[model samples]
Target: MQNRSPSRRTVLTCATAVAAGAAGVVGVTAGPAVAQRRDSRLKNILARMSIEAKIGQLFVPYFYGASATSPSRLDQERNLEELGVRTVAELIAKYHIGGVIYFSGWTNNIHDPHQIAELSNGVQRASLALPTPVPSLISIDQEHGVNVRIGSGATQLPGAMALGAGRSLSDARTAARISGTELAALGIHQNFAPVADVNVNPANPIINIRSFGADPRAVGRMVAAQVTGYQRSGVVACAKHFPGHGDTGEDSHTGLPVITHTREEWERIDAPPFKAAIAAGVDSIMTAHLQVPALDPSNEPATLSPAILRGVLRDELGFDGVIVTDALNMQGVRTKYGDDRVPVLALKAGADQLLFPPDIGVAYNGVLAAVRTGEITEGRLDESVLRVLRLKDKAGLLSGSPYASRREVDRVVGARGHRLTAARIAERTTTLLVNEGGALPLRGRQRRLLVVGASPAFPTDDTRTTVPELARAFDGLGFRTTRLATGREPDSAKIDEAVAAARGRDAVVVTTDNVDAASPQRTLVSRLLATGVPVVHLAVRNPYDIAHLGDVPASLASYCWTEVELHAAARVIAGRVEPCGRLPVPVQRADDPDKVLFRSGHGLSYGTV
Candidate 1:
């Protein structure tokens, strides 16, 4: 549904002239003469804008074309123009949107980094073409390493676990810096990255590989380094999913995941990374949708809680930057409060901007209605608008040259420098979990090898190619390799066939996760071990997977099954790469069922050399 537009005369007519009077007061503020003049000019411009326009500025919604997920059946741009639509640039000119957040999955044809950059810049330019051109607060989730949306030619770095395993803050900083530079070159002014969640829950479905490690201090330290690097590269960095989304076992994407913890525990375990990010001067903070009863017993998620966003994040934590809500359409928020109330509640609860509201027209009108009804005052709108404008100014969006040249974007998007940086970070972050029985560096005479796992597959919609990439890397290193897939569960016949196939082989490599304990793959591994063949079980999901396999002659936990990690694993298994990675998290032994097996940092090495 479209917004109701008031007559031009009615909009031009002030209801109370309070905004004008306040604008005058701001205009006459005594400061250095030059500063006063600029402030007066800004105040005058703000004064001329209607409340609807101002509120519209604070509501940034996600826009997608057919090329993104599906092309728009209707011509959104033509419709918007016909509606006197305040494009994002107009919002900047009128209300000053804090920034635009880019989600890769929201687009239709973003097959690679270059396309993403092109599409984003094209949109930004179109938005800027509006009258009284204003710079857009262009943002994207280019966290690189992993969780990257711009895949194609972009350098795919290792996940956060790899960085924690590397144990090098410098490497983390370098990774962030490279990512920031690439983002900035693509006309992106902000990066929602360096997920600061302290991964205390091993069962966390979404944030496992995204977090740096289980240790709060380690996660905090690495986040701080990354923040420093991103800001240094002139891209405002955002540390996200506040109040911690890492401790929950469920994914918030599908439904509301309640985090049951006391305020004390929350303060102890979930607050460090945020504190560190704030101290490092992160420019923005994104709220999570999880329900934390201890923080706000009113049953409101942290995203819509004044006690949390205002009292805790702003007043208590001393964060003065923009407070952005997670996507309003996500089930966590939408399923509870409904879309009509999100903007009003979020803004009133202290969020400065609503990120990707489900319905922009509804959000715009709802917020405008709230302001008109005094649910949210015009002053509140002004406060958020000013913060957004200031951020735009800082991002050089207001410097009159809001768009980067296409050539400049081309030069930066997937530069060799970025790929090399990603590769270096990936190489260092690769962790080696176990090397029992000195079974690695297989004898030159031993040519038979069997590799099995779900990790090796073509990059299809359903699966990634980490395992296949590793297998190819092994082939490059001169190893004769045989591949097998154990579809979450190995077939009994297939298991027996694989066991028999490996009888005369020098070694066997089995990749599986303990989390899938009930799967047939675990049973397959046990049967293979029964053959007395030296089995090198690579725990690709979590080190805890080792607990399901009992005692094997050799085992390794690479933590994540990303392509780079698979390559690292292949090198270590073939003795081409030394095992430098240590377990960043604990591993358990199946025999000692009740006892914890490998503690954090516990991983056996074949030898230093």
Candidate 2:
């Protein structure tokens, strides 16, 4: 044997070089079996595809309702035939289009998941019947919890913040697994969910309830568990708003949101959850239209920035997955770069899929022109195509898996098990912020009880479920309830007057609607506290409102103004349920707020006797 292992120095140097190269190649390569399968699939599909069909595959358009009022209405039956759905079967029959993402507005009725599934199946079946084989990548935003779109038959799980408050990774995983199982049962292979954004900004308008919590580690752990659960249930979970949209103050739906943090902060706070999700094998990553000047000096949003998506996420974070864009029609991209040009820019910027494009034809043509002009190479397109096909294959679409039946859809979407899970979460997440003199668990036969807040009416916003409905859950709980509204600070004097009127009454429950703006409502809380009335402060918004109340007898932080929280609050106040909710975010001091207020584990508990 002529020293087959070689000298120590030579071996060490070669091993180090190989390690470095392997790290670099991780996200770039498709691997041996994956590459071979991709090559074979691509060749088989491409041989039957026309130039138009190939171009169509490059553009994944948004399909709105059948009306012309909306952006694009897929004349599915016609488009399927034209795209060569009349030809072969596998995945690429007529159009090699990567995927289709369903939204609420696209359906005949937003509440009807069955109707949506029927329409979706119709399209998928058409694709299957095509002469040239092509399987469809059907996707939807089924992020159970707050951002639920498919509502009618779907389980309404607590929001991400609620899950964070539960302090259980298992809770997050179960929520995702159940949601994924339900979505899969409805023929939805992809879920644009388990938002990996680490919510660091309290002023983040859009991502508040959508984010799990402010802590990167907690968010990361939850995301990993959720992604694993979804994948295990045979649904492709996409960790979204990549490179993190957690620190922005503005909503991307309205305009471009910017994060002014340094790269170090970005990696530490914002990127950890995404890193965790990627490590946990998230099938896809959805890019946000956010401007992080420190990460990409080009001033372009992450969705259209190769620096953030290709360099940071794919390279630095080592994520080898599909990179899908948020709705291209949104103002975040449309205002900065015109609607017509965003598709080409997104593709050139390394986005594998363009979601909800305003004009599919224009986008398709633009990408084709870019490839022809050498802006986006054929190799790049192939890479994206391969990734799309691989995901479809993993989803069992490539093998012509049978569509989920209506009974199966119903069994999973709003099953008894999922609802019970939601109820359990609701029971656990209700928190009590203040209880002085032990005024809570109000004793027997209280003659009068007052409830005060905004309008005392149901929230008119379609997005929110009402609070009064939940308050009704405590109808026979040994107290007569009175509802009132403390309109403004000047109204606080009126509230004081009302409290004086109800003096010697059993208890005064002053419901405070904590708006984003800091108002003079602190005076009202102080007045109630001064009177020695058993004051119970109920915050409908941020839990930080607790810091304003000076030694109130009893206080509760509902986090949300929804009906579920309202009912849960009633039970907690009535001593029917213990306050098990931990603070998801810090409750900072009103006068001198700390960067991090109450730590993650701060929660009140009323144990069973």
On TM-score, the leading prediction is 1
Write candidate 1's Cα lDDT for 1-609 as tens digits: 111222333233212222222221111122466445544545554676567556655666655442322245453563254322424333334343435655554334355555555555554544444333344677777665446665655555666777887778898888777777666666677777889887777678878777888788888998998888887776778898898998898888778889898999888888999999998878788899888998888878888889899988999999878888888888888767767798799998988878887666667778877888899988888877766654554554543344445565567766788776665666565555555556676768656677776553422122456555666776777777777666566677888787777777777787885445577777788888888877887777666676676667677766566665677777677766566666666654555544667676765456742
Model 2, 63-96: lDDT tens digits are 4442212222354443343332321122233345
**Where is model 1 more than 4 Å wrong at Cα?**
1-49, 66-99, 456-464, 500-504, 588-595
Please tell me which predicted candidate would have the highest lDDT against the true structure: 1
Off by over 4 Å in 2: 1-35, 58-60, 66-98, 105-109, 129-133, 444-451, 454-465, 476-514, 517-533, 548-551, 561-566, 595-597, 607-609
Model 2: weakest 10-residue lDDT segment is 17-26
TM-score of 2: 0.81
